[model samples]
Target: MGLNKITGILPHENTCADLVPMAYFYDVLKNIQKVEEDIINMTYEDGRQPLLVHLDMLLTIARKYPNTAAMCIYELKRKHLKDTFEAWWERNQKKIPKKYRTGIRQNADELFDELFAIKSWAKSE
Candidate 1:
């Protein structure tokens, strides 16, 4: 299904718009269950990766936007659902994602450093 546009969409600090990528991920999960091989073989027009677009992009979206919505309560629901998905997928024969050194990296370095004060010494000196 080549890139197309249709949204049954949400919002906002004065209409601040956003898209929950995890929604796409939920659809992908359904497809994975229905046709695991087909989902695994799928590709995107944009480019390629070690895994299928669904595995890489949609799964990454699952990580990035884990929650179905922006509210705190929704995050809790997402955590539970994600945990369930992980347990279910673990039983499948298909291989899980592999992270080579060249694979996509999370934009989490500064957050981790700030959380652990990894660079706090620099500030004092």
Candidate 2:
């Protein structure tokens, strides 16, 4: 999906209630990546072909993180959020596709899980 399509799903910023819902939108993106990686490695087929749903979800997730990160920076301006996010963004820039680089971030926990799974699978085979 395109950036505009996913951003349209974000809640209207008229009420305080929008905060949690917007955050949950990112959470759904995270979960989609989780399942995507699971499917990629577990499905017995051509590895080159990615699931279309996963690709759509990834683009959505990629498109949403900047807003999420910016919100995080605002909420935790006094904390290390800005610096930490910058560092993460810089370090992982190459790993993320160009579409996601502008907005969304890679979910660290999901990345780690995928790495561990790949490692374990490699050892087993």
User: How many times do residue backbones clash in model 2?
Assistant: 1
Which tens-of-lDDT digit does each residue in 1-125 have in candidate 1? 54443443423111222333545656655553443333233432122222233334444544455443222222122233334333333443234244531233232222222222212112222
Q: What are the TM-scores, per candidate, against the unseen true structure?
A: 0.27, 0.29
Assess candidate 1 and give its lDDT.
0.34
For model 1 the local lDDT of residue 67 reads: 46
Candidate 2 residue-wise lDDT, 1-125, digit = tens = 43233225445443454466456545654654454444434442322223334434433533454354333322222123224334444554666667755444444434333322221112222
> Candidates' lDDT values, in order?
0.34, 0.40
Q: Candidate 2's error at 51, in angstroms?
A: 4.8
